[model samples]
Target: MGSYDAFCKLYSKGLLFTKPIPLKDGSHSMRNIIDQLKDSLSRALTIFYPLTGHLVTKKGDDAPSYHVILDCTDAPGAQFAHAVVDAQVADIIAPDDVPPIVESFFPFVGTVNNDGHTLPLLAVQVTELVDGIFVGCSINHVVADGNSFWHFFNTWSEISRTTFRNNSNSEFVPRPPIVKRWFLNGQGPIINLPFTHHDEFIERYLPSPQRERFFHFSPESVACLKEKANAECNTSKISSFQALAAVVWRSITRARQLADEQITHCWLPVDNRLRLDPPLTADYFGNCIQALNATTTAGELLSNNLGWSASLLHQAVAGHTDASIRAWLEAWVRTPFVYQYGQFVDHQSVMFGSSPRFDMYGNDFGWGRPLASRSGNGNKFDGKVTLYPGREGGGSIDLEVCLPHQPMKALELDPEFMIAASPSQAF
Candidate 1:
């Protein structure tokens, strides 16, 4: 787990998935769905057993350091809660901004990942709405990244759908996770941290208050961004994701109204699954990601066109080869640093996580596809952006943008940004 040691102080990643229910079935339908999900989750954990475990620290023999490890000997199960909300589906999906009530759907809002030692690494809350259902999942960041998180979710839904359709009493998993943790050649399964106590390490960690809004980009809009960027650059090297990220970076920087000379950064979490020497399997069940930074002065970024910013992002991502990834790992092993909240307080920056390429709309547990998707109130900060595949599918993308109240209001009014974004009600 050396690769994920830095994420220990961060908050658990939380996601909320909602779908409408038929009105005729009433309470019985809700009860049946909850029961089925619980049973299927129980079976899923047998394969993803580490999620049900707790993190423990041990003293290193040679150095005055602590090593964190998952302890599943007691088989402490994951938390599952069922709650009933008075509101209907329209109350949540109708708002232009993500409603405050959406955060309540999740199990852990402000809990940090280090709390996994005492709390369940994974906690799920099934909030029953008047005319819909919201399934909220909070998974410890140290245990899994977005890929692994969705892998477990997809498998759980598959199990539930299979059982519902077949009405059989057999355990089956469509895709099993690769639980073997990967490490550098000289690295160990025992990852040592410089901190002696968890409290002292994370005592200063505090999340800033922010407002989150969803922006939907249709397939045509995405294509336009890519086309315009490529035409400006006089090359077709800029990918759609790069072009989209470029627009977001420029728009937010403009909304923040930073000084022309100010240094701004855009950090992206690059997946290392396929970028390693011997590439790990796609289903490798852990955090195998590195934060890659692209930087420029505010003046340069704002003065340039979208293609310029897109090219910068493309270069940063393309340069993260296998050798560079290993070098980063080796450097971390020498001096382990646990990333805390507000790590970028000194800079005007943006951080991107949760890719749109994941199978966001495919988690159908015998019901129809999801009507919408949302995130919990954990790990949120100004300038944090999470991308999801649009519910409409195709090449469409949805961005969940978080920022301070004033900047968020300004961003909503920015014409350049609004031209590419669909109205919030479209989802």
Candidate 2:
């Protein structure tokens, strides 16, 4: 978990999954659905018991610094809440952009991940919408990354679905999580943080005023982007994700209207599970990801074709081998560094998170598949982009883009950018 200490100051990752209730007479009642979810969550916690635990701060024996550890013994269970919202599903999905009320759907709106010490590491809100249901989950990043977050979610839904089918908990978990946290051989199970006081270490980061918008790209559009990118580069080395990211990076840089020579960065999180030596399992339940940065001058990025920008991103990702990952871990263990909120405020930079590869639309809680997915007001900053698998599946993608109001308007009007993005609708 030392690899995840840097996330302590960051906000919890919040996601909202919304779907309509079936009108069938025998369909599960809202009360019944909530009860089933609550029961399944409890059973899931038995396997993922650490989530019910809190972070314990301990002082180093040799130094005056502090380190954090997960304490699960006799801890209280995860937090669960039932909520009622006076809105319909259409009110959420009919908008040109995500409704502001969506933020209220999630628990722990502004809480940082470090608050897991006092707050629940996992808090879920089952909001009852008029004729619909919204399940919002906020998980501490210090405990899990996006992969692990979804793993727990997927398992919980599986348990709920199975229980609903059998009308009993038969101890069925499709993929039990690997709770053993990963660490370097010589580093430690005890990781040291730089701060002494909890208050000094935690930050309740509030981003600057920004407008959030969802852009949908159909499979055809994404394929066209890949084709054009490959044709321009005269190689098939650039992948679909790389090509799409390049388009977003170039377009956002153009919209920001940065000076040609100004430096711009595209930071992408690379999952190191497969990139490490001997490789960690896909189900390893913690942060095994690192942020890889691709940088270029704004002038160069704009002057080049989409393929060129994508090639830069491709190289960054390809170069993140096991050796590089280990080197980063070694350096971090020597002198730990935590990410602060303000570090992501650069106007000329874009940070891509929440992979479209995640099984976002597949989480079915026995009733139905999610009609749409959304994020909450956590870890959002200017140029923050979260990618979700399109509801239509296949190769489609939904980009939840956050930007300052002015640049967002400019981006919306940018002809080249909008050409590839499908007609905007609520995701």
Candidate 3:
């Protein structure tokens, strides 16, 4: 097996990390919080493996792993002495502006913080306080999925709690690396495409029109939506994942209709950890297994009932013996086809549901659980959906909608699209 250092290049290539805040209050100390996070990260750093990458722009590879820096926003700091300031700065206290880590990995990479998804990926701003602390980090998806990242974060919290007293056991035993069962020639998924004469597939996937963001729902609200959906579809038992899938599928379809588009597509990233015998440990890094796919056309999708639509989605992703999904993902990841074909998907959305509930509630970093948790907006996908465990026993889903301003307005008018909480408008 290749050494952990072999995986460092891959880990650095894949963006995997998150911005977490303790609370929204303004009394927390940035130094203490950073120290805790630094310790937590250091304990888990070995598991993350060698941080490898070369900055081709300057022809140098020596640099510290990404650091936390504070960017000044209009939000207030400390006492309520200043004017009604509302700017927010990064929780990380850095001396000055730093180039993005991604830039070092991929030359000619775009740089700018615009929409919700891309914003976090580029740079995160933190607001420090006693009631709560804000963190901003753009975690790339190539290294570890939500599961891997959570596994490490939880360990950090667990160890941090007792570190002051004694060296807690934050054992990060290296998990067996994913076997290179496929040919070394395999290029991975194909994501690049040529649209029209000038537009590229990647651009279409990350449309400039839609602003990416994570929208969260309370446990009660999620249960209510799922209950209503279940009642509507009596034959088959549906999950909150399916319910949200139905809603988003329906919503996207409706948006397409208003936009005067008929043909559409959607992709779901399938996890193949369990599909393998002696399933990959929670620590397994790199791309394990995935399947990128499209649903029925918009015309048919819109005409069908929610239950029917959900059933179709369920059927598309069900069943697995060996890496059936992995085989598909390998084909895409190994090739440049995804880059070419994605442009043809006039209306496409990527959705993930049924995420582990343990990721959120269990991630207590000393100051109790986070008051709120939401999904990160990514510029790579048009629409993104993530589901977390609700308070009761069901599931809650966060959705980020990206579309033209007119379609967004129409979405607001619909009864199903309830405004949960506004980012800029509400505190």
TM-score of 1: 0.94
Candidates 2 and 3 compared by TM-score, better number: 2
TM-score of each: 0.94, 0.95, 0.61
> Considering TM-score, where higher is better, how would the candidates rank from best to worst?
2, 1, 3
Top candidate by lDDT = 2
Q: Give per-residue CA lDDT, model 2, range 194-288, as digits (tens).
A: 77677665556667888888899999999999999999999998899999999999999999999998999999988899888889889899877
Q: Could you say which candidate leads in TM-score? A: 2
| Cα displacement (Å) at residue 369, model 1 | 1.2
**Candidate 1's C-alpha lDDT?**
0.81
- Two-way TM-score contest, 1 vs 2, winner: 2
| Span of ten consecutive residues with least summed lDDT in model 2 | 6-15
lDDT of 2: 0.82
Candidates by lDDT, descending order: 2, 1, 3
Deviation (Å) of 231 in candidate 3: 5.9
